[model samples]
Target: MLKINDITNASSAGAFVVKKGFGAILAVTCLLGAACSSQSVEEGGLQPVALKEAATSASTQNVADKPNVLVLMFDDMRFDTFSYRGGPVPTPNIDALAAQSTRFDMAMTTTGLCSPSRAAFFTGRWGHRTGLDDNVALWHSRQTGLKDEEGGIIKRASDAGYYVGYVGKWHLGPNGMAKRGAEFVDTYKKELEEHERQGAPYGRMAQTKRYLAGERDENGEKNQYYLTLKGDYDDTQAAQKVRAGQEMIKSAAKEDRPFFGVISFSQPHPPYRVPEPYASMFPVDEIDEPANYMAKRVNKPLSQEIPWWPWHEVSHMTDNDWRESRAHYYGAIAMLDRAVGEIIQTAKDEGMWDDLHIVFIGDQGSMIGEHGLYDKSAYAYDELMRIPLLVRDPDVEPRVVNRIVSLMDVPVTMAEWMDLKPDGAVDGDSLTPLMLKGDSAITDAEDDALYAYEWYNGAWFGLRAIRTQDYKYVWNPGDERDELYDLKNDPGEIVNQIDNPDYKAKLLSLRKRLELRLVEVEDSSVTRLQRLIELNS
Candidate 1:
């Protein structure tokens, strides 16, 4: 599905390359990707030179050196409890990192939150080039970072030499992520504020007594509400982000370089805590509901028919509080699949898993209660916008690419798998030719709509979306009832049919394709969807 055909002919050579439909050149090269900072130098960062490849397809184009990336990420994970959804959560280290990976069955995360999708996965740009719905005002935006006229992805993977380790949650800008690449980094916020001032992240309620049962404090030592046993797995927080991803993969394999690590985990988010055979492993009537659980509509808006606190208290929850928050959200995804199986068994005990290019993502995706919602706002439901992309690229092989992709294509698919070329025009465009032509017509199979944006919960949380794999078009320019969904017969977006009448011409052709993708991302919410189409025509 790589056919953006040079983003409208590289937006007339001002530059925006990588053609062949990654959601129509990610809104036409991020809408003329800021005219490649005034072009000229061979029209800015070239080297895509075309490919429709025929000579027996499959190729990563004669693999060029550079393959030592890690990137785990994972915060509010969703995609129905991964190991690719054989749910009842028990990830076995993300199903052994999705068994030699490439999993992505329709991924997404344009904006689900956590500093606007990790500032569009480290600056491939989105969320109005990282500003709206602020993540510390997009870590003080210079267009979501690495600015000196751009060269993100950790300053072009530390100026193409690699060795760039950034550990745990930086919520977008820890002083512009301590100026990008450091041979080693840490944003654990003072070890999570001294593990929440020694309450040890409320020790998941000492394995659920539901607060205050042997919970100590006031000059108390051992005040972390008691470790939720199951052998208090190193007092969890995904085991201190897997021991800071095993000390940054043993200090980047004793400084032999070629590293890129990024670990980052906060866990199945929220105080859901885990550890203890994954907090007594799943069983709340076998955790399965969400066909928009407790679904409702009435033209849903007003922050979705009043869903806020505990999803407006999900009808006084019980079934053991939704099976104890879905067994502590699959025991925080089996305590983050046992800290992603000790950071891939410390990168397969430092022999660095084959060629090691690992990348299991998820900066967003969660609506735990769905419809009766709860957290993650600026709605664009698909369980708070799909995310669970696993790519193992040791020159590709393992398959399954239902392709919808976009977590702003993870740093231009890591600057096109280290062939590095980051300088200007960046509005994402690289899945390495749809992960080397794996399947599902990855791009232009025409879901010709995949934008996402939402103000950081204010001015009525202005939202804007344009998903399309069978319809979804949110547009709450400060609420007035604007949403439509049909995701092939409601993929749990539980009915909002935008003033339905057999979907008034698919809601004005998805509001004129979301006003031409919010006018190629220079956006403004198209005059609030044209004032509800001139006050309802």
Candidate 2:
């Protein structure tokens, strides 16, 4: 990681000494130039300090010029939800970004959950390294000397003289003023006990009670509830969080140094709550059921053993309930999209549009009735593993890469764009070369198959999967069973081809490939244990 020493004698007087009219002219020229070059800048007229010859020369004499970075991340947003990806949701802001930026069609997450995925993103390492493999495990790992050695990307930027600010949902530890634990039963009990002891809102448990109990005034509105215990599905809370994020962006812009602002929104997760106008954005009669709406576990060759509560629960909901739920979900997405629009607009209003590098992605994907799953896990399926990754740099070519990439590539990619060295051992290679080459080398390269693992919810030890362009193979070490799917034929993963005689050889080869990768990345505890079990057997 890059470290900076305090310069006691730094003179601020020289930093702003541009000849009056010349500064104005330069800013205007850069704005106009950027506006003419791309639709991204044209749509939002925010131009940061341009890195032109004059600006470069000015910076040589004790002046500093760094690009502002804004990361917009949504919670529980499925990879297929965006309109750009041909999903049902009409995310215009995200679509516009995809149209004008480098969109990675196969950005796999290291883990399929929230904190673990975000930890991987920030540390440029997998879940095991960050000790955040699962929600509760994060705390346990922290106590056992398995601390997050890497302070994450935000801390890195901050250390490098960039003003850093994080707004909205921070699921990574310290409990976010919420007691951490299981969902309803044990976690809630512990939280309530802590709340009674502390006599205030201490953790998520208290926050849930406060929100649901309607303790806080909703902008002084008599009947309006300011907070709700409905998880991220509440659009009213989502909107307020969005508004808070906007204020953070504005504050970051006021900093003298370059800023790195992360606006993380929690929404479209569960409890399916939305405010009045947005709550009813989509009508029940107009809502369309998911393509695999009535899919059954028995139809799957893998023979589903785990009971998925949300999917099975939502599956039994009446058509009206489903429609209302769908409406609320879509409305939540729209609310998030509008929040993105607000941030973009604010950047424009601040005249820092062109000189900023923007990245938009999801913390983790939500399974809205795909294969009868509602949220993400380490299942290694496409819906859970794949995430939408879009990056917009002022000088890069705007194109989409269908080649496989991982979320771990994010920090390195951003580092490359900023001309900075990455802070740690990056598990993912930068996509810059492919971005520059376009679709020419995209199909030619033999990219490593994407991998994902999870150790959460007292489920299984871990689940591993390897995905190629046309084929995907999954291994559950605990069960000693595997699943294979020809993605070209079954994109929804409705069938398992693991036992097919014709593909038997291919399955073994893919299994070895996945095992070797697990060994290479050192992400396979179950694989090692499975090996010992096989030897004993």
Candidate 3:
């Protein structure tokens, strides 16, 4: 495992530079350009300066010369799915990208739900702060999107003279993506509207109702409800989204403005509908169970008492059934990998690869038989929180970030790269310092810890977590099932150390850290934790 101490100063590295009478500036010197020297502002000011030179070069460049941003998102993808992570799946495309990118192995989302995670990714804020702390159901149509004054990443890029486009999953509301500042918007709203117009069942809820009503396809398969149509791989929702992204990129190439396109894939989420060879690619018999598969849920939160969904409950699944489901899930990832290769190849063909800042990430992960859980619920386990985050900036060298980072940091990092102003104060920090300077770059205490929360999962049993590299502490407000895990000793999180006398000090320290973060984010759940802290004090 890579640690902060393992990272050495490269020929091209970033450093913090402070000028007299002026505020401290974290400058990334000797990037894609020539090698330059960098000095720490703490060590006192140095003579060498390259930021001004880089800024001058940038000011003279045209819009076409500016770097384009391409954000590709996956749904419900685990961190260890790709070959880069030594998982079962062979994602050659993603593997190649990871080899040339900064892989955040410890990347986590603010929430494990799709809507809330994506909302944080866009707004650079926590889910509860944005009023999108859960999935958007029919009653959540009023959850709309970020206000114009609330400058989101998309709006910031648009304001910075980049032609922005968004295609595929935007779960903030019914038509959130369409109302964004995107010049080209292609989401599921139109498809659902057309389905409703034709008097056909639309949306996941309707599909779930139809499946529960004993509706089966010609193949007599009851689990084919997730796909609106199942024929060719090209006709699948994932492929359609990729094609839309390609078209958007191609169209943006014709314009004089730089492009910022987001292509979100809904595949590998559930139902695992991969057509043709992909479906048979991963043999079910060869599939193996996860390390923590069917592990006793002792000392875990009570929220794991039930499965996430009715149709895919773990209780109804046998050993072979679990293997088959896992195989299908791998097949879905392989299928999505092919689609990813296509979109990236399209960008390269259009000459956008040279200057494109690419970001590939999963909105959040799901429990694939981890601790006997099928899907994501109100749990802050490693399986549900750990996501794949690969960032390939043309200017920054490729490396691995071993520390924990949040999905909300995506927008803040991009804003720093593009020099765009966000709406207001954000909970996330720019990752440039970490990417360019490594462990020494983390000057703030907040950067050393990652926080996650889940408010709804059929109940209001709030779960707030604070995790560092060595340990993880989960606070179950108003519940007695709070958890503490020594990650260094038990990475699988099977042994909860909350009750261990040896870990009492560690638990108290983590609880205080979590309380501070909750107060910082203005989360109401912090009240109960605060009272508990007072009692302990």
TM of each candidate vs. truth: 0.33, 0.73, 0.80
What lDDT score goes with residue 33 in model 2? 5
Q: Write the per-residue lDDT of candidate 2 for residues 1-537, one digit (tens) a residue.
A: 111122111111011100000000000000000000011110111111100010111112211476677666665566776678886678897687677688778766667666567667666788665666654322222221124345666556545555455444444543221121111110011211111111111232333344345443243221111111222322243444344445555665555556566655545544343455556567768878865654664434242444322222332334454456556667666666766666677777767676667777776665655566554544776777777778777677788888887777787776555445456666767777877886566553356455666565334446677787788888766565667888888887777786688887787767666766666677756466457435633
lDDT for 233 (candidate 3): 67
Clashes of 2: 9
By the TM-score metric, which is better: model 1 or model 3?
Answer: 3
Q: What is the Cα root-mean-square deviation between model 2 and the actual structure?
A: 12.8
Report the C-alpha displacement of residue 365, candidate 1, in angstroms: 2.3
Flag regions of model 3 displaced more than 4 Å. Answer: 1-65, 138-151, 190-230, 443-449
Error of 1 at 525 (Å): 19
Q: Which pairs clash (backbone N, Cα, C closer than 3 Å) in model 3?
A: none
Using alpha carbons, what is the TM-score of model 2? Answer: 0.73
Clash count per candidate: 10, 9, 0
